[model samples]
Target: MRHSRILADVGAALRFYSRIPVPAGAAEDAFAPPNLKRIAYAVPLAGAVIGLAGAAILIGAHALGLPNLVAAILAVLTCVLLTGALHEDGLADTADGFGGGASRLRRLEIMRDSRIGSYGACALVFSLLLRVALLDGLLALSPTRAALALIAAASLSRAAGMLLLEFLPPARADGASAAAGQPGADAAVRSALVGALLATLLIVPSTGVGATLMAIGLSVLALFAMTRLSNRLIGGQTGDVAGAVQQLCEIAFLMGVLIYARPH
Candidate 1:
């Protein structure tokens, strides 16, 4: 691909996945909705950039003598802010829809509602708690390793979420996912490959090849489970489902890495 096309794809991925403002001059139609079909393969690159931003906050907080837990929270908070809690909102909505609705249609409606239900609230709390705890534990081992883990998890989770776009039809005729369109198998495969390469390179030096492979395997398993549950519950994929799966895979990846990582 030409450099301009590659840059456009990267910009589109960041525009869709983050709150960061791309320069208007980058493209004539910069304000147009991102084309996910071409952009999906570049999503992992956007994720790695976001991870770098979060890692900066994390390392800076730790360097200032903040507690590891506090540093982790701040780092996560930075990521949430950068992404406008985009994935977290999806996770909350998915939890509410799946837990409270009676049918596929009703579930989609529940997910679209802006109001937070008990199920949504509980899901958000638990997700945040687990992420913070996992990051804290990793930080306790080594700040550098923890930073790299954040990058790997971010990139891999987004890549895993692409499986839904590749394998499942959209549940609704209208919505962000439907509007953006499903990514082609080629784009999805490229995404997975890029995410895996970035994750392996970042994780192996600190966690070793065995732990990195284990983490990747567990992440794939989590992705598969989420894919099955979403299909069963909603009849297809949605933007919310994608977000929820990404969150789940990230947690699974962290758990796998933390279980095997040792202090160096």
Candidate 2:
């Protein structure tokens, strides 16, 4: 019973940050957990739910003989629904911050503004286009493989987000990232290893061990590049940097799939 209550409280925290509304009195203490250990687990669990929804949409679209374009739209829409567009907004804000500002303070100020900028617009478009294109390509493979890939990508990308939080300092004194900064390095490392193991198990059986290795390697490279960029741009990382990492890692995984997955 106590465990259930804790999980509910954690769920409320997740919903709160993700901008999804929960019922009143469901769980009031936002920081009751006071540690991000559960959050590390929660993130991938949420991703799994979102990924399952996306897989269902893809499978349904395919059965209906829907065009790749339509399937892509549905898949993206599913993500939007599940995450409430939280990460997308983060990506846009990060883009505006990095692309428009001359100094760290200016960039941080830009990111805080509600108005979207040209850089944000371009980043959103590119990110969506990349996701859609890669998903469409994946769907061309066997349905089972596509479904597994969706789940793996969603889960692992979120795990990547948690990884950034573990190693990087909060760029801002008070922001979403700071609030999520309760996970210790050990917990983050364990979650990351678990996520990687799950991804490897899922992808290797379907796409071959070679493809799985390639995907994991590319994801690592993407993570390194993103972390370096975050340090250069903001002196460390914020929640936005975590979002950017997830987005880039997802792209890297897709690119790996394209390079390795045999054409149908």
Candidate 3:
């Protein structure tokens, strides 16, 4: 019975994050240790799957001589579908909090609001534009490279979010970050290492020495900035901060790739 309960908890965690719907009463079940592990592990796995899907779409488009614009649009759609637009919501909420709210409490309040604000609107526009541009450039290089880049970016970004969750205190008593805080340190460490290894595999082989170095440098810069931002806002990191970190890291990685690709 105990073992069955653990499995049920794992299923519930998976359903909470995935596109699947959680049935009524599932939330009443206590989160089991195995279930926590499942949730921690599932995050990067899902990102990898999404990345692979995006790569497939890009490759198919290239093979059929589909326009870059069309390929880019499809890739964005793929990401949206796979993640269920969760990260986008985080980005928007973060933007609203930072841009318009004057205090920590106010920021939290603004973030909770479902309606989009001007800051969120602008942030979404810029994020989408940059993602599409970077992805298009990557596709132009090679379908294989594009695929690897997407996979690496998706995995690493989520891993980065996990890292923030592990290190930082949750801002709200009730929220995703607080819920994720239940995971043990050892499990979190293992998850982080796996995510980092996967990201390294994707970037190092195709990017070569200069690009890899640039990516590392940019990743460090992003981490530092995010740490500072997290500290300033709400006294620590929230779920939204984690999402913002991922989004920023994605942009940073793309910028690194672009800079390395630049001609002398």
Who is ahead in lDDT, 1 or 3? 1
TM-score for each predicted model, relative to the true structure = 0.96, 0.89, 0.83
Error of 2 at 200 (Å): 1.7
| lDDT by residue for model 1 (149-264), tens | 89889899999888777889999999988887888898889999989999999999889987798889999998888789889989899999899988888888887789889997
Candidate 2: residue 190 lDDT (0-100):
65
Task: Order the candidate numbers by lDDT, best to worst.
Answer: 1, 2, 3
The 10-residue segment of model 2 with minimum total lDDT is 26-35
Candidate 1 C-alpha error for residue 141, in Å: 0.5
Clash count, one per candidate: 0, 0, 0
Query: Per-residue lDDT of 220-253 in model 2, one digit per residue for the tens?
Result: 8888888888889888888877887887887787
Which stretches of model 1 miss by more than 4 angstroms? 24-28
Q: How much is the lDDT of residue 259 in candidate 3? A: 64
Report the Cα lDDT for residue 219, model 1.
95
> Could you tell me the TM-score of candidate 1?
0.96
